[model samples]
Target chain A: MTYTFHWEVPLQNLPLFLWGALATLEISGIAVLLGLLIATCGALARLSKHRLLRGAATVYVEVIRNTPFLVQLFYVYFGLVVVGINLEAFSVAILTLTINCGAYCTEIIRAGIQSIHRGQTEAGLSLGMTQWQVFRYVILMPTLRVVWPPLASQFIATMLGSSVVSQISAEELTYAGMFLESRTFRTFEIFFAIAILYFVMARLFSFLFSLTGQKVFREAWGQL
Target chain B: MRRHGRSWGWIAVLGIVLALAWTASASAAESTLDQVLKRGKLLVGIGLGAPPFGMYDADKKPTGYDVDLAKLIAEELKVEIEWVDTTSVNRIPYLLTNKVDLVIATFGNTPERAKQVAFTKPYSSWNLVLLGWKKDRNIKSYKDLKGKTVAVTRGTTQDIAITKLAPEAKIVRYEDDPVAMLAFEQKKADVMPTAEVLALKKVKENKDMEIKGLVSRSWAAIGVRRGDPDWLQWLNTFMDWHGGQGKFAELFEKWNGVQMPVALPRW
Candidate 1:
């Protein structure tokens, strides 16, 4: 069928969409950072000698990784609201995103920690380092460097998944496109624009993560 | 394996030819109305998430004004109804594709949509409003909506209205009415543009929100496939009878808990 295509609608709403893109970045950035913190604890727990600690951490990771992220988000946003714990949409988005990302991040970082040789721990202990110091300086830091690339990609996936939160009406980039499409009936133009914007944002985030990685772990990058 | 594959391919070809012949004969045998009558069922599409108009009850059965209306139509036609739960976005598509003989969704009649499907006479009218928390006295009108966050269902009548009224407002659109309501309830949005009836129900339950003001009014009508003059006339006649007998108003009040409109605009 023949039809006219208009790019003007999305063009005029460019500023609004850019603002939403920034929100998406902010949500993903904060969620990833917070997720890494949770993952560190989870990874350490799974490695702990105590059976309770390891079992609890393993259960947390398995349950989250097994279920769909959308269901988890809905449970957190809708299920909790029923009990009178009403969290704002943005906070709910970030909170669920972090917990969902944490499960996978735990697996990645735990693998990195397990891959470490026993000799490194022995050398640190021989040098009179305390257990906490050995883990913080010798094990955790190096394991993070080893898992950095995969973890960064995981964070990127989390950012893409953030689009699903628009179901809850969080004012993210995808929400902007849907809002514009509803107003103008220019579905093709708006979706095309949003697809391009998301592609650019994903690349931009990947580049930023690489730059930050280089700055934080110069020696690690050299060895890689 | 090769001999088995050859035999299976021939069977597939024969199956396709038989299916084509069956459809060709079926189309040649009767018109759409006659087909529906002969089949002893009318396929109707009804909106699922729009409460008071079309929504599922706690028992998981569809119960709403539209559902009741469709039931009446089916009774008059002396046929059973097979309902296809539809969304605002897909209701028209469902009718156009012949997936449903009629759409009793809260579908608005507009010239833009008329080109795609035929609209029977309007059965109901609902006014849209910008509603917010009762304590938020600052937002009295559309002017106060500037730079505020408003939630609306995507591609709905209210969504388009708010864009025209307050272009500067940050409009957050959801997939359906329920999600939009959830967003407003969670205080994620400063205001919401929704139907007056829907907003009133929420206000009465929450005791914290009020209808700020009117936004726009839309007439809801039944939709049918294009080029079906006979079927269209029958549906229009059914609505005329129902409306004339006051059954429409009775159903309206039964679902909305308010009096029906005195007059629905003739399309």
Candidate 2:
């Protein structure tokens, strides 16, 4: 049946939908931020000379990579209670997302760290630069160039994955659609609007990432 | 050359990491239900969109006939009701997977469904009712549906009714009931067929629609997972007492403005 484009939702509950959208963004953004921090640490650990640090990093990468994100999220969100590590729902959402995204970012960033070319590291070492200086000066900038796109994409994925947080009542965008459908009994309309909101958010994120990449990697040979 | 070597190493690292995670889950072999109930609330699986049966309110508190009704059942079970909102496509899988203890969502009883789960005797009955513009006086009966398009919820009895009674008529399948009601309001179709009480409620709530036919009644029952005879029997008896007494009838009239169908036998 044809329906009019409703100018106003009957209950005047547009704010719920908007609030849900913002929550989705916040969760995804927080996850991506913390995930980046974790990925750096894990990537560094993998490069460590000590077997324990390297082995631990290796185990983390293998386990997180193979499992489904849904299963992992459930484990982190629900399993914490078994160990008496009680966390709020929002905290779980952010934590699960950070862990899930971290493993992937570790792989991508490790490649960037490794791609600094032996010549550059040798050049830094010959100039009496410490290992730390070589890593920061030679490795960090080069790796950032190669990994920026995937990092942006990972953040975008975090945005979508935040929907799973609805299972734990994080009250994100999909949760808003759920709330609206319940109240309005306008299930299809509510979901349709939600899908549109997600689409717009994803597009906006991609646009921002593209702009940021241009600024960060403008000197890369591919651009020239 | 070194760049290619590192990329290949990363791939190997990725492979090993995944295998370890899989091993842990394989060994755990725990149930999702035990985990949920231990948290002290029964996580109910329901299609929060289907109204009068399930769904929530503007305040984000779940409120509907199904929500209220389920709250009663939860109170009796002495467990807090924690809703796990789902879609129509997800309900059965949710129950069989033990994501919910029971569903008070308005699932019509069918012989096919009996294979998958146990059902309490119907606490409510719903029928396909045709709705039209309030001023449209002539199109009040199912017989009037010939040669005209009708709007129905996809995959429901309304779709079946349209296909069976007026095969020549075009049927527009909306995703849910309220959408169909909106379609009827917009004159998108001459009539919309839905659960009678829901159609009546929408007609009263909206400025434009009217309910025309009571059509046919289908049994709406609470379902439990199959093989749980003890739970099943308890639910059947609970429904019988609460709904059989005048209390159920009084609530039905007070909130919904209709009586339980008399022909349906008690559990």
Query: Going through the candidates in order, what is the number of backbone clashes in each?
Result: 0, 6
- Model 1: pairs clashing at backbone N, Cα or C within 3 Å: none
Least accurate stretch of 10 residues (summed lDDT) in model 2 chain B? B23-32
Model 1 interface CAPRI class: incorrect
**Candidate 2 per-residue C-alpha lDDT over A1-224 given as tens digits, one digit per residue, 9 for 90 to 100:** 01222326523777887898898999888888888889999998988899999999889999999998878766775566668776655787888888888888998898888876789889988989899988776777668777888888888887987887765445688866764443333443465567667877987898898897787666553432
B1-267, model 2: which lDDT tens digit per residue?
Answer: 798689758856864575454334323233333443466677777667776666667888877777777788778767787788865435654665566777776776766566556788877675677777767677777777777768665545566556677777766555455655554554657887777777767777887777787666677788777655666777777887887674556655555677765446743
Model 1 lDDT per residue over A1-224, tens place? 12234668789999988998999998988999999999999999999999999999999999999999889988897789778888867899999999999999999999999999989999989999999988877898789888989998998899999999988777799888876655555655677678768877888888888988878788653543
RMSD of each: 8.0, 17.5
What TM-score number comes out for model 2?
Answer: 0.49
Off by over 4 Å in 2: A1-12, A218-224, B1-267
lDDT of 2 at B69: 74
Give the per-residue lDDT digits (tens) of candidate 1, residues B1-267.
Answer: 798689758866865675455345323323557778989999989998998889888999998999999999989989999989887765754664467888998988877677667899988888888889888899997778988989888777787788789999988777787877877887768999888888887788888888888888888899887676778888889988888888877888899989864466432
- Candidate 2: C-alpha lDDT: 0.70
Give the Cα RMSD of candidate 1: 8.0
